[model samples]
Target: MDFIDEHLNHIKDKGLYRDFKFFTSSQSKYTSIDNRRVLLMASNNYLDLCADDRLKEAAEKAIYTYGVGSGGSRLITGSCKLHDQLEKKIADFKGAEAAIIFNTGYMANIGTITAISDQEWIIFSDELNHASIIDGCRLSGAKVVIYKHCNLDHLQEKIKIHQGKKRLIVTDGVFSMDGDIAPLDKIVELAKENKILTMVDDAHGTGVLGDNGAGSVEHFNLKGDIDIQVGTFSKALASEGGFVVGSKSLIEYLRHKARSFIYSTALSPVTIAVSLRSLDIVKNEREPRVKLLENSKWFQAKLRKLGFNVLESKTAIIALIIGNAAKARKLSEKLFEEGIFITAIRPPTVPDNTSRLRITLMSTHNRKDLKFALERLKKAGMELDVI
Candidate 1:
């Protein structure tokens, strides 16, 4: 208790202590949190499918039919019909031979990386990859070679240095913090040259990238080329599970070998049903994706024009680098006071001296909402001298 208190106090002093905001209403453009209705710009619900009426009805139907919980581990009795259907739907959407599901995106990364790699193989990962990927590499029993974020030349150099060894290159399709995309075309080409496998954790890309929301591989037209493509339903798909799409054999291998998938109880029936409905919405309605991207481009351009250091982000996620943790926290608090909710991302989620405000756009956000947020943001930035 003393150690916990000491560390917590230290974190608080550093302005890195995190506290959750309780939502008193559904996930929408304006959610009631802390008894105030604030415009939500910190959510990952890029397509705004979380509170869709069809999805809610589907969830209700599923709950009425299947109950709340899966009784045991998936390998025991937890596997349900809805789970299989959702996997097939996701596989088909991703244009893969098959797909396998996990309890969450973190579990998906950990399970897949550890299940596929051993001590003999090396993993070349990007320095800015998600924490899940970092932890997965640690647990994989493989030598991990980290290259500079999105620096293909450094990756090539590392690959040359580790010649003649079985290797895997893992990266995020859309970096969660930075929101910049990976160059999958060049990565695939490099992997082919070295005969190494490539894996992409497309957690932030699923249901948001590509023509029909097939994610980064599809966005890059490299479908069936990347060895493994991982995504999560909790993001754009608006559900509570993760999936990996690849060859049928790969899917089978994960089903048998991935401890996270094998040991964890399957996702609830309502979640599976809601995910299925969300997939249908993502596939059938192209307007949401179009609107979301347009809104992102407009918002990013507006932020940049206002002199905020928005990094090279072309996706729904955007970051305004504020450098100091305390300042970033202050900016976030100011935005909250202005009835906007954007989070301050500080170390160790990001490197030291790179703390920033991470904002995300949703298709459901209107022009008025964007205008209000922009006005509030400019005011806050002026108050803090960030602009």
Candidate 2:
């Protein structure tokens, strides 16, 4: 207990202590926090479908038909028609042979990585992959070699240095923090040349990238090239759960080997119904995705013009580096006071001395909303000397 207090104090002193903001309203471009309507600029609901009528209707219908909870795991009585349908739909969407659903994206990554690799396998991972992917690599007992973030030459060098009969190259399609896209096409080329399997966790890319919004794989036109593709419905899809799509053998193997999937209770039928409906909506509705990316580009440029250190990005996520943790937190607080809500990302989420404001845009954020945010950010940045 004394050690716990010491650790808490250390983090607090470092401005790395995190707490939650209770939202009284549904997630969208604007939400109620502490009864005050705040412009939300930190959400991952890229398509802005979290509170969509269609998704709500689907959830209600599923609830009426299938009740609430999934009473067991997937292999047991929990597997329902909705679950099977969603898996099939996801497989078709990603152009994979089959797909398996997990309770969360974290579970999907952790389960898939650990299920596929062992001490004999060497996993070449991107340095900036999600924590879930990192945790998966740690749990897998594989020799995890981290290449420079999205640096192909470094990855290639590592691949050559650590030759293995069973090897995998895993990366996030769009990095969640920095918002930069991975060179999946080049990665695929490297994988093929080196005879290594490839996996892409397109959690941030799905429903927000490519011509058809099929994710970074589609953006790179490398469909069916990746051996194991992982994604989640929690972000852009505006639903719940995570999934892995690949060959039928891979899916079958995961069912038997992935401990996270085998033991966890399946996602609720309601969530599955919402995911199914959202998937249909996202596939057809291309305008929102277009507007979202366009807005991202426009907004990031505006921030840079205002003298903020905005990171270059192709997705809806943007990272504005503030460099110091306490200053970053102060900037976030100043923005909150101006009716804008952007989370200040700090160490371990990012490297030390690279604290940043993780600003994410929703499809519903129009020019007016963005302008308001810009004005507030400008004022806050001036006050906090962040610009």
Candidate 3:
């Protein structure tokens, strides 16, 4: 445990140590943290479905009808009618031929990426992709080539230098930390010209982008062009599972070959129920999506007007870049002191000297709530000389 202590000390010295903050209440406008009611802006519950009364009832019904846990992996004893129905619902929502669920967004990426490619394949990945995608690529035994973040020219140049039967290009639909959308349309066009497969992890985009919240691919109008679309229910969908949407053949292949799916226990009955209902809400309700985007744009505009660097974000996620880790931590602490709850994201989650506050907006956040957060943020920025 000496190495563990050393590493912890090293991170602490750099102001990059991550300590968990527990919330006593459900995800909402206010949550109890350290016995204080703080305005919650640090969560990914974009649509505010996490604490909906309907979902709570659905959870109760599901637990009563299907029991507490899935007994085993789907291949063994876990497959149920609810799982099948949920998968179908997901496929329809994504406009894909089929979809398969996994225990988490991380597992979905790891399983899908590793299953589709091998050591003989070459993967062209964006530099700022999520850690799950990075890990998946590493585990795939594939030759990985990383291009500059959202730089189409760099991606094209890298692609030209590589030749392989199975060349895959992977990127996040919406960057988690940077809060920017990938150039999916351009990526699809490039992939077609090179006959390469394209994959997008739309975890942050699902239930928050495009018409009826079909996700970033729909926003880009590249539904059939993209090969694989992976998303999660834990974020805007307000549940606890992940899914991959693709062709029927691809789904069947994953069912047989994806080690994460084959080995891990299936998602619980209550989660599946919650996810199904959440998807219905995401598809049927236009108000939440519209309000969330409007809130994000308004908040980002306000930040920019306050002389804070709000990165190019067209979605509910926003990032305020503070170059130094210590400064970012100080800003976050300042916000907390003012009864606002936001987090400082530092390395290795982000690059050194680019630490930021990964602020996420929700539809449920009213103007008053936002004003409070903004005021706190302004004070922090002014005090820190960050504005």
Candidate 4:
């Protein structure tokens, strides 16, 4: 207990401690936090479907039909008709032979990685991959080789150096922190050349990229090329649960070997229903996706014009870098005071001296909302001397 307090104090002193801001209202472009309405710029609800009437109706209908709670794990009574339906729908949506659902994206990554690889295997991972992927690599007991962020040449060199019969190359399709898209096309070329298995966790890309919003694979026109594809419904889909789509044999293998899937209770039927409805809506509603990307581009340009160090991104995420952690926190607090809600990402989440504001956009946010945000940001930047 003393050690825990010491650790907490140390983090607080360094401005690395975190706490939650409870939201009373539904997740939307604008929501209530601490009973105060603010423009939300930190959520992953890219399609703004979290508060959609259609999704709410779907949840209600599912509740009436199936009741709440999954009752047990998937291999037991928890495997309902909705679960089966959603899995099939996800497989079709991602253009895979089959799919298996997990409790979370974290569980999916860990289970998939640990189940497939062992001490004998070798894994090539990106330096900026999500924490779950990093945990999975560590848990797998495989020889993990980290390549420089989005550096194909580094990945090629690492691939050449790490010789193994069972080799895997895994990366995040859209990096959650940096707001950069992985060069999956070039990575695939490297993998094929080296005969290594490839995996992509498209948690941030699903329902936000590609012609049909299938994700990064579709965005890059390499649908059937990647060996393993992992994604989540909680982000752009505005639902719950994670899923991995691959070959039928791979799905079967995960069913038997993935401990997270085997041990955890399945997602409720209501969640599955919402995910199903959201998928249908996302596939058909291209206007929102287009509008969202357009908004991201416009907002990034505006931030840059205001002299913020904004990262280049093709997706709906914007990373505004503020090198000092305490200063970044202060900037975020100032923005919140001005009725803008943007979380300040800090150390451990990002490398030291790279604290940033991870601004995500929703399609429902029009130019007016963006302009309001930009105005607040400009004022805060001036006050904090961030510009």
lDDT of each: 0.92, 0.95, 0.93, 0.95
Off by over 4 Å in 4: none
Residue-wise C-alpha lDDT for candidate 4, range 1-387, written one tens digit per residue = 799999999999988889999999998999999999999999999999999999999999999999999999999989889889999999999999999999899999999999999999999999999999999999999999999999999999998888989999999999999888999999999999999999999999999999999999999999999999999999999998999999999999999999999998889999999999999999998999999999999999989999999999999899999988988999999999999999999989999999999999999999999999999999999999998
**Candidate 3 TM-score to native:** 0.99
Q: Check candidate 3 and list the clashing pairs.
A: none
TM-score of each: 0.99, 0.99, 0.99, 0.99
- Give the per-residue Cα lDDT of candidate 3 at 12: 88
Say which prediction, candidate 3 or candidate 4, comes out ahead on lDDT.
Answer: 4
Off by over 4 Å in 3: none
lDDT of 2 by residue, 239-321 (tens): 98999999999999999999999998999999999999999999999999999999999999999999999999999999999
lDDT of 4 at 225: 99
Model 2, residue 217: C-alpha shift (Å): 0.2
Q: After superposition, how far is residue 253 of candidate 2 from its true place, in Å?
A: 0.5
Q: Using alpha carbons, what is the TM-score of model 1?
A: 0.99
User: How many residue pairs clash in all the candidates, one count each?
Assistant: 0, 0, 0, 0
lDDT per residue for candidate 3 within 11-76, as digits (tens), equals 888898888898788878788897789999989998888899989988999999999899999988
